[model samples]
Target chain A: MGGMKKLINEPADVVSEALRGMGAAHPDRLKVDLENRIVYRKDAPRAGKVGLISGGGSGHEPMHGGFVGLGMLDAACAGEVFTSPVPDQMMAATKAVDTGAGVLHIVKNYTGDVMNFEMAAELAAADAGTEVLSVVTDDDVAVQDSLYTAGRRGVGVTVLLEKIVGAAAEEGRPLQEVADLAKRVNDNGRSMGMALTSCTVPAAGKPTFELAENEMELGIGIHGEPGRQRLPLAPAKEIAAMLVDPVLGDLPYQQGDSVIAFVNGMGGTPLLELYLMYNEVQQLLDRAGITVARSLVGNYITSLEMAGCSVTLLKVDDELVRLWDAPVNTPGLRWNA
Target chain B: MGVENFTNWLRDAASTLHENAAYLTELDSAIGDADHGSNMDRGFAAVVAVLDEVSFESVDELMKKAGMTLVSKVGGASGPLYGTFFLRFGTALAGAEITPATVGEALKAGVGGILARGKAELGDKTMYDAWAPALDAYDDAVAGGADLGGALAAAAEAAAKGRDATTPLVARKGRASYLGERSAGHQDPGATSTTLLLESAARTLA
Candidate 1:
């Protein structure tokens, strides 16, 4: 299998060691709480400001944690391998990150993530009196039964929402504004993913799931869960259609609609494949009479070293376009106005 | 169950997790990410470290300490779910001696905490699937005038059955649920591990 290979002391120690590495890599910008297994911005709990927190599993590197800086998340709770971070971690993060302005939880739509964050919110409300507002990101269109799902699985747009909503919060936007903007992003975005090969979780010391050599799983989630269906591997254009078509078809991105198109790699896939897929996706969008206002092509959110990609389209307005262009600095992505 | 028996049960449970840490992760690999065993091992290790420091004057104190330890050490869904279980259990047993009826009450409190925390119904293909039925069986066993060990053993058996039932379920919650239909045909690692916990209770408390 041409998949992820990592160097670590043991499968069990990856998260803790990674947190330690993060602390060492960016001491000025980040703080690692070994006790709580949480990553925090060094100067967090910025007085009188709404603290933003998000987290899930460990493989989606530079996400919830790496985004913990200026104009992004204030703290992120790290869970086991691909499991959602528990309520205690969220509660700890919420309390540590809270100021007088309340705290916001940017949760992906997964049962575990939602439930854990909910419990944290309850604890924060009862014990600490910390005002907590949670916005769930469910941009993935792959999962059909929304009622059966813990809702939709939050995918690529989460990274975008974190940035946009983080900016709003940084500008001292009220909790309600930041929350509403997050909801707006959720309402306007849709995503679909595919897996070329399975990802090997370090702790598992093996792949959690499998994929055949000639086939790929469609509508895959970040955890290497098999998608809506499996199909023979095809050309990048066909694959892009497989991904973008569902997202666009589900939402019907129409003429004159401007979108933020994101082509994200699942991890093991190279940048070369990502660029190729992005080109194909762009062509598909153009053919559908949709205009691309902003585009990002890379592995912003990943599932270990799974070989695959996902496409996310967020219909944009003037305000969202401006926020997308705003200056922000984090480990995974950076831009200056 | 007396204080000594409960303490013994707790220690044995910790040892079981420690011994089967890799086994738990192995089960996780089949259906979920492979960390349940390790997470439980880490949490219980912390519990063991502070076992001596806890005041057993009340069951609540010991359980509360265990819950906090798991929260501080374990970082995944199990941490919060199991931690909340202990926390609510402790609250239920506050200022009380350990007894079969009290144990049933604590189990109910734990199940309630899991429900409030996870929002899982009986068939969500989560640890709640095992826990909910186990609590119900524990209640039935107690009401039928079963002993503590017998009651726990019944609960453990039900949990094992519940865990086995998840093999064919379409998961509706957690990471496995994202798999949808693909999530079927795999025994839920969380539920399986939860059954182990009850089994330990049955064995140690017996």
Candidate 2:
């Protein structure tokens, strides 16, 4: 109700100051350009390798920016909280990371993000003659009527897409192949989210929306965009069923279909609840005869201190599992580094 | 009018946005991510700053610079949509005489850029909802032998009506569309801002 009890010193400086802290904290792996709001892999521009870049608004930490490293994204442009990055930052990132092999953009299909990236790509091609390929992720199952809405909102699958496609690019795959792989990951992934509370934008200094004490919003998006419905507060298992069923149905994951099941916390929810939700999710998938080939649980993509969780089911094959298992070192995610 | 008129329009719009920032944010909070007010205010302030330092040789150059400033400074659907509007508006006005018909053409061209960027249709509960009506009003007034100020005044009035019309229609574009039926009762922030810019033009451009 009063000034948001956030750790930020000023509402305007949250994104920049956070970048400064990120720079200091992970100097070995990342080089933060505070002025341009770009986080780069320290040893970027690896010749003969296609560059990988993704970006969106801030508040969803360890995504886009945090994924920039050895076997992941080459660069990420950070925007204001819940706002898309402007073309200037994107243009610079595209130019900075483009080795001769060209650069591939992994964008989430939000209106602002899509348009700004399109303008940046147009500018890059027109002025500098740089080759740029873009694949926008629209994997959320929340938007039921895609014919009436702005397709499906991109949610949790973006994290998986960057890692998988980033690994493909690290194999010296050409731009077209890398782009196609990113798109493939996008098409195969499906996500559904639910929020227990609303998040406050720093400048707004209040909750973006509200929910009654005994209510929760289902089909939520990352930035606190309202989901399909609000229902009475339910238990962890019931909530998990609500989140997982839509994802399973949307992609129509058949029996014997193996998948990477991810149970992610919205920034405010605790890890304990996520793990509990994961158990329910696994049991549901088990009943459906779908095998959980791989699993990730935690706050990989999140809204700002919003209490909720999203379930993402990526129908994966051996190729996806292998790429996702590739060695990677970054601040937010590191495996077999 | 010359570049000074555009400079004034941007400055005036900046003040208006700053004044109404909280209201816009409130509207967005209902159906969107609650940053439209701040984004528009920030983008227009940048445009005003550019006007203060850079002297322009032509109205087209001035408008193009404003568009580039908004594109570079603002981040969101508003940035590209408004930025493209100004850019195309300026492009259409290059070296042309400032007649009522030419301004109407420029307005249409600017709105066209918005449609191309957003891909939103009428009754989509977006800025285009306000724009479609405003454009029609501008043409009708121009055809009725109205002066430039009178034509823009009519357009601004129609835009206001369209902005009010967005309150009951469900959103079909942008972040608000995610709410589906829940988005119906909230006035679209983009449409509200579009009307503000048109009203500012009525006050300054004419």
- Residue-level lDDT tens digits of model 2 in A1-337: 5557989898999999999999899899999988999999999878888988889999998787889999999999999999999999989988998877898888898999999999999999997888999999999888989888988988889999988888899889999999988888988999999999999999888999889999999999999777779999999889888888888888789999999999999999999888989999999999999999999999989998999999999999999999999988888789988
Worst 10 residues of 1 chain A by lDDT: A203-212
Which candidate leads in TM-score? 2
Residue pairs in collision within model 2: none
Question: Candidate 1, residues A239-323: lDDT per residue as tens digits?
Answer: 8888887898787788889999999989889999999989899898898899999999898889988899999999999999888
| Candidate 1 C-alpha error for residue B146, in Å | 2.3
* lDDT of prediction 2: 0.91
For model 1 the local lDDT of residue A186 reads 87
Give the DockQ-based CAPRI class for model 2. Answer: high
Query: What is the TM-score of chain A, computed separately for every candidate?
Result: 0.97, 0.99
Model 2 lDDT tens row, B1-206: 77788788889999999999999999999999999999999999888888888899888898888999999988999999999999999999999977789889999999999999999999999999999999999999999999888999999999999999999999999999999999998899999999999999999988
lDDT of 2 at B32: 94
Give all TM-scores, in the order shown.
0.93, 0.99
TM-score, structure 1 vs. true? 0.93
